[model samples]
Target chain A: MNWHEAPDMRNWILLLLLLLEIATFTFLSGVRFDSAGDFTAYFQSYLGDLITQSTPTLLLAFGMTLVLITAGIDLSVGSMVALVGCIMASFPGNTEFWWTAVPLGLLTGLTLGFLNGALVAWLDVPPIITTLGTMIFYRGLCFVVMGDLEKAPFITVPGYEWLGIFSGVIVMLGLLYLIGGPYVYHSRWLRELFMMGGNRIAARYAGIPVQRRTLQVYTLIGFLGFLAALSFTARNSSISAGSLQGFELQVIVAVVLGGTRVQGGSGTLLGAFLGVMLIAVLEEGLRGASIWGDTYLPFEISHLEYIFLGALLLIGVWVSNIAHQRSRA
Target chain B: MIHGRLDYRHRRRIYFLLAGNLLLLGLIRVLLKEGSSFAEVLRRAGPDVAPVILAGLAMTSVIFVGAIDLSVASIIAVAGSAFGVLVHHDQPPWICYFACLAAAWVLSMWNGYLIRTLKIPAIIVTLAGLPFYRGLALIVADLGIPDFGGNISVYDAAYHQPGKFYAGWILLATIIAALIWEAFGRTPRQWLARGNSEEACRLLGMKPERILQSAFCAAGIFLGFAALIAVTRLQAIEPGRMLVGFELHIVGAVVLGGTNIFGGEGSFGGTILGAFFLYFISQALTYAGASAYFQEAITGAVILAVIGLDCAIHRRQKQLDELA
Candidate 1:
């Protein structure tokens, strides 16, 4: 394969970008370490905080990879997260809240995902239109449920904050990416998803249960949304109807930036991990470099994150697409 | 596919939307206060509803060519920001409006150009544009105006002409022209042909990519008017928050109008009816004394129910065709 054609080459480039981002940000932010012990502790705390804070986005990105791999997109994941959190937070902050609200949130998430699946699989509505409708519908429901109130019942719930820390990030992401990812990467089920994405008719003709698999994939995302809600609420400790208005874009950008074919049929979980870290670092770096920006630039440095993100997405997808075509030739 | 017959369901959908609009109008009539004039309500509906209608028309043209522009709200925001910046610079009103129109047209064409050259799907391109353009708007505002606040207030009456005084005329003229062009012009037929199957269009000796680009070009004209009306109607243009979630509403209305979401099988006439139907639904609810908070949820439900049922009704035919 040509250097540009190899998937390994693509990932290496992403790794390069990540390192470049970190080094530049560190320099611009002008932080210095005086001692090895101090450096180690700072590293530990910063990594922990970064991973924990972005847990909601990371969890959503995992499901998004599966969805995109199957040639479907979910515009409603952001709304789904908010709706789940809103529903769960409406309950009184007591031990009973966990038992009642948690179950309800799970049920709601699964049901919402099922709705999207049914629309796509059964009614034959295109996934974009179906989810676009449901996105608005779900966001509307969030408002109806919580009105203007920002509820934080999770803050008062005992032991819930555990999910917001490094330990929680380890368990949740490990289960999805570390364990389940490899399993799916090698499974016949994964092959089926790729087949469906490549061409739906051929997959159906090959005796794949198209509707069932579609439903399962979508509902699985819903369950992931439930987990995301848990992580987000634990960290942020409050929820509103519009809490994550543009969140689906972030997750989609990360997954797409990972070199997942938007046209479907090919992706790797490892690539997705790199994609997430790259974006997360850029975001954090831009934020941290505000002191540098205050004097040098007119606009806020943090605002530049949007421009970088858009540029990154366009460039990332364009390169990955070229790679995909070149490798085939 | 280039010569595929129009779907009966799409034809029926137009009638359904028409009926829905009439029925909602009746409800609004019945619920109106004793002293209020139904004539006034009818007259005011045009300017109030033109933004969505115009935007839906733009979306319809794009979807007709198997593409979607999710960056519409962002495009409008950028246009609005351009208008605001120009206004703040004390440019004439016509110049400001023209700048707004031109900015929208250029960005829309840029979306077309990128999709064509890069061979990326329209959805992905515009999805990126959604944020990129909004940020561009804010940055433009921040740099262009001194001591820029979040929003720029347009206090001049002349600045509001397109959205306030001439919106109805602009909408009517555009719709009439669009419907006529769609019915009689070769370009629109080419768009439908390209939408049906780009490969087929190519084999037929038509430039499918050019056809697609032309569709976007045409959509830019309609979108220019949409941005003009949407921007000029507002007393203040806030680049960050303006038209937030407006793209979804336009998409919903377009889809609801019986246009196929994937493109190649819908009418501009149906889109007009769909937009009116949605507007009247909200009007009826307001007149019926429903809470404002419930209105958005109800609009969403209506979109889901209408589109879901329509898709379901068409499923049998789709399955037969696929299995064959």
Candidate 2:
């Protein structure tokens, strides 16, 4: 009945949904089974690829989780990542990438994030409107920088491709979820964030320094966006002005699916992690089932991804609310 | 009479929009080639900016009741797909137009109902609707038409009449009707009142929920026209890509017109001028030979600058009130 119990119960539901998804997709994709060992190997690689391919989304979802916890949304993360990637791509792909483009990309991410923070915190613009404007502005800047070009400098960077692989993603996930998440779970700072989200006016009156927290949260999203850009470019090996379109929605949906309330006040890092995997699994599963879909369905199998994503988001929120109300009742 | 009829707050915004409109007009006139007449520019304005204007009007009501519909673009896509499918079947113009308008109206009303009944925030509902409607459009297209390609192209000139020729008339008539309604009608004021204080409206025997729903219905009517013009103007209806990010432009225009983003105060005249101001800025950039890439950046900057300035100007007053 308490907050702690409510989330755990929701997590159980999510895990069950995730299991159902995996079962359905595995059957649809028609898993090959020559032997037990071969089947295990196939499953392991499939899972690894899903996680690795979704690393950027996972990293951004971590930040988005915290942002939504503060009752704010960042609509510019996609544009921010694209801008950072586009900026990094302007440099040559060589050993010098470490010294030249990497730091600059971080700074770009920080500066852009700070601008969003300032608008929302100091200028008092609503987070959604401010980010909406910056989203277009940053995207436009990407076009100006790249000029309708796609750059693949990331592929030529020394050892950079490692970051896009399974091991690198696993390391990032370990740091973010296993280590950093627990650190946040007990941190007074995050508690203060929840307080602010619950009631900004009361928190301010209670000496929470609301503006500073707002600025910090947005700036944090920006920093995470930089990391996301690194993972994305390293994996995809290409950057274009139009890259990562609709990516913010994907991250938000994943976090929301993981049981983070959009109204803020409560969230769990583990929940977001599960949420991202849920979507990633669905995506990869759909792609894997393309043959089956082509034979059975009337439309492209991938087209169903959009419908599923939307439906799952609505259903997730709807289910979570029902659970919340039942607990209170 | 005009001075006596308006509040000091709205009077200031009206004057500001008028000055901005004049400035943009002069800038455009200067940028045009030597022989080009101002009349020619004006003539093209209505059709070119009809969609944004109508959508802005649609947003104004929803915003007036302190809600937003981010799914307008997606709704337009669905409507456009329906229109396209009908056209592909060689349906009469009235049937196609009716289908398009009906789709948009029904979606808007559905959104309103969902927001009311589900007790969810409009933003969250519509954020979900954004993808849901887009995917729905694609599904509708796929199921309705056999041998569906990605796009449905309407080659007949007759189908384009509403967008190409009648758009100007539709826009003008709508503006006049909106102005008259805003000035004298009860519904618009009810929206503003509900926006101003939902609790107070309830205390006054007004149902805020019903008021919000009515605002959405009015918005749906405007959105129907917007979808009609928007779809007709396009030679091809590609549901996957149709009207992506169109909601931002509408929001920008509505905000630029001095409509409160939180609702409670706005005018149709201001939205009309605001939409024109934005259109002229892009047109001026084209005439001045600015790079195509700069158009979006300029528009974003302009929206940010206007909204930021307005917010800053009011911040001191808000702070003063808080202190009091």
Candidate 3:
């Protein structure tokens, strides 16, 4: 068979690339294994750190995949998450925050998301424009609520710290990816989203209630944003107005790089998982590879993330387009 | 019938902007204090607003052709980096300015080139360019300056002249030229044709790719001027932090000007008005003594309100057309 007709080649390539990246960066960072146990210990800790750091991104990526599959985007994801954190930070650090701040954060997230959905669904504004406007709008609201202050009520909150740790976050990710992923993958809703992304007017003609679905998809993103805020604030123990700046792009890039379509119609939860891992690994590797960068590179090692991100997005899109063409052919 | 082709919505948007700007000026005049200078405020508005209008015009061209360029802010940052690098090396002021213009122009055309050759969506190509160029800017800055601080300071009077003195003139010159060309130019009309329907344009033997390329080329020139002014206006050039959220501001202005986000419609004149209208809103907020933090929020709220209203008003018509 022609290479273009190969089944699921990109995923395999990504897996190989992930391993290659780990090996290269591990070498560059000069990690030595004292024993087999030492190696296992290091990898375990590294894997845990990666999960804790990427919990928010992975959660939001699932929502973003669903949104893109419905032919929409949520550029306001970063701002939405930041706003929730900022709102929650305003409450006292006592147990009351769990009841008051957490619920308020949830309400704010849903309301903000519903606003985006209503604008796109009822008012007929484009998703990009609506979210772009709300991105700035919500960020501005964050500043308004928090001012120039940085708040860390989560640090004092009882039992909230576990959300940032390996075991707690791992369980959450396991439930989301393992259980929810398969259900969504097989559900009728996913098929409807695929149709809507493929052709909105046709889906409406097919009685998919395009408007309601659009509303639901965006509102669901709001709930995800709240969850992301929960994990982020718990892990960091602080919140600021401008936290998670450019985060939406990161998630979008990861999801898109994972084989999700930018123009919508088709995406995979598995691809999103791999894509986020690919980026997360690259970021972690680069952070460790600063020793090499200090001698050989003039710019900060972290800056390379943006360059790699762009390249990876392009490569993924190329893979996707080839697959798109093969299907058409 | 000078605007004979403008639909009712676009026309109302123009009128609304005109009245809005005038009302804002009036409010500013009222809010003027005894010690403060209203005339100075009016004078500052020209140069202050030039970069935005130029960028808006650039956005207008690409958006007119049904494509969006989300990377122009990063392109400008790269231009600023080039300008800073040249200045740091003791290059002539002219060389620095020219490099700034050329850098932005080249990157923008490169975007068009990629989209044309690769057949990727313009949004994706530019969106990729967003961070890609930002990293490029930082690397270039890191490479150029010996002791690369985060920002490069230009202190010379000569270097600052373009942004400080000639911004208004440059703005006027570009606006006049762009509006005239837009009114009488076959090329821009071809862009509109392609934007409306690529397949139709291809069937008619007009190269949609070439037209799309032209839109980017035109956008590049406008963006070049915008970058030059914006970079020079700043005493310290920080490519990393400069124009962080500027892309959305340009999009807001373009959409407010009645350009369809998906393209196939809009005007330079409308974009100018929309840019001015947004500027005036912030100015009005300032004159009303709103907090600095509140201005961004209010500006966002205002954009949402206007766009929301415009879309709502046209929703019925859109639904009717879909049914038709």
Candidate 4:
């Protein structure tokens, strides 16, 4: 059975999302026509900030896509980010601290992720319950470590500034694309995650190392969380326990929107990337528009965005089900 | 011979459940402080926690069927907001109460339909509903009524009586409904079946979709009543922040009460006691001067501990059964 026969509707969704975003941007930018230069400048700055702001979520989503494909979730990623960010921002004043801090953050993330893997894979705990418990535990630990205080700028080293902006995001994305893109698309071990998600018992009976793969996937998410935290803190120039609060939800939404089934198996990283971009751009477009732009939609911008997201998520699943049914028929 | 064996097994299960409840209560008592009046602590914790226990039970019913409703808190918010809005208009208290309940039920049914028709997982559907319903509550609150500015106080006799006394009656009614369900209902049976193995249940002539829909509907009614209790207790509703993080507490209570997270096996008695135990623990911990942060951490740990213990017990029971 060629699984690739499934209709690649992710491209269409991405196209539609992007078109809507561009239209919103165009219309909203038109509102300030009297000051064209100011509008253009503000738009550029806004776009820059949006890209930088979205980088961390994008990174997290990239790793999350793999985990979801394996039919597991990494709730501790958000806490991992906060913890790593705290560590990065709490580096000693010495210039040599970057070497220690970066490696230490990554190590911490890996260890935590591995622990999650161990609990679920080795101890036979259910993934949802295990991650749910760790989600709170890790967050509480971060609070304890940081003493509930926000960490100040500690990464003021000469070469560190490059990790915070457009250039940094591009480099990081490129590295991930190089390493992960092929590993998922070409490698056999990696492809087993898809098969495992499709049917765990079948995969296990086929001699797949389900437990080991689960461990590896969670560990990857932890490392990505570390990278994301490093970049996020550098961009923001500070760290706090609340730095990445509720981010796991955003990652899940992106992964699902990008055509990754929440039930696991059958997804692409590119789709996840587009999903993150779509949400970020939608928010940016709404903010550009003068229509209740001051308040974040659900809480502040505009409640319409959430409604739109909910509708899109429902529609995506419905369409996918229809497609599956039709293909079977 | 079969009847005797079944009776023996049933008695054993009851004994086991009772022993678990007693252990939990004893743990709470010890944790609170020895030599203090345990009866007094229970009495004080009872009324203070009556509403949460009611709401948690409603949530647990849905969870037992292997579905979750994250929108319970949102329902509470909207119900409270609607009640406040009606009272602000000088509407009769009875009308406001019924309206709030009706609104919650309709919203909950919408959740049920979304999950049923769309085939979306409960977690995703309800996560989306959480914010969506909260937004509705906010909008309703924003549109202030004629007499009152933006807030509705429950100082009036009509509201206070329901909030204080009748709300407990609603909880008692829920317990009765659950008992009736356990005793003579195909709905609960189907739910358990679906939770265990949907495919197998389907092969066995059970319509999983219909059973799930009915389960959600029942859960919706319970949630509606829970929302009423919340509104009456709060007297005023700020839909924006009402019952934030309340779903966690409900799930924690359900799991602590001995319900399997994977679904299929649990008892209402265990869950009711679980709710009481959780409330008592929180009160006792607070009384012992634990900070809010520590309380949250401890609560999370307790949930993990309970689930872990349940898993261990379940595994051992399975092993014993297999040997037999």
| C-alpha lDDT values of all predictions | 0.88, 0.87, 0.89, 0.72
Stretches > 4 Å off in candidate 3 = A1-8
- What DockQ results do all the predictions give, each relative to the true complex? 0.66, 0.63, 0.73, 0.30
TM-score for all predictions? 0.96, 0.96, 0.97, 0.85
lDDT by residue (tens digit), candidate 3, B132-217: 99988988998898788799998887899889999999999999999889888888778777778999999999889989999999
The lDDT, on a scale of 0 to 1, for candidate 2 is 0.87
Ranking by TM-score: 3, 1, 2, 4
Ranking by lDDT: 3, 1, 2, 4
Candidate 1's residue-wise lDDT over A1-329, tens digit each?
Answer: 57666677878888998888988997898789899997788768867877887888888888888888889989899999999999998998888877899999999999999999999999988888788888888988998898988988887898899888789878999998889988988899988999999999999999999999999889988999999999999889999987999788888888888888777887777788888888899888988899999879887667677778878888888877887777777
lDDT of each residue in A1-329, candidate 2, tens digit only: 55435687778778888889998998999777889999889889988898899998999899899989988889889999999999999999999999989999999999999999899888878777788888888888998899889999999999999889999888887898889889988999899899977987778889998899988888988898898999999999999999998888889889998989888898888899899999998988899899999899998777788788878888778777776777767
Residue A116, model 2, lDDT: 90
lDDT of 4 by residue, B170-266 (tens): 6767778777676677677677778778889889998877877777777777777777777887756677767765776676676666566667656
Candidate 1: clashing residue pairs, number: 0
The residue-by-residue lDDT of candidate 2 on B1-324, one tens digit each, is 334555676778778878888988898888889898889998999989999999999999899898889889999999999999999999999999999999999999998998888877787778788888998899889888887788889899889988988999999899899988988889888998988899999999999999989988989999999999999998888999987878877887887787887788777787888888888888889889998888888887887787777677777786677668
Off by over 4 Å in 2: A1-5, B1-11
Q: What TM value does model 1 have?
A: 0.96
Better of 3 and 4 by DockQ: 3
Considering just the first chain, candidate 3 attains a TM-score of 0.96
User: Number of the top candidate by lDDT?
Assistant: 3
TM-score leader: 3
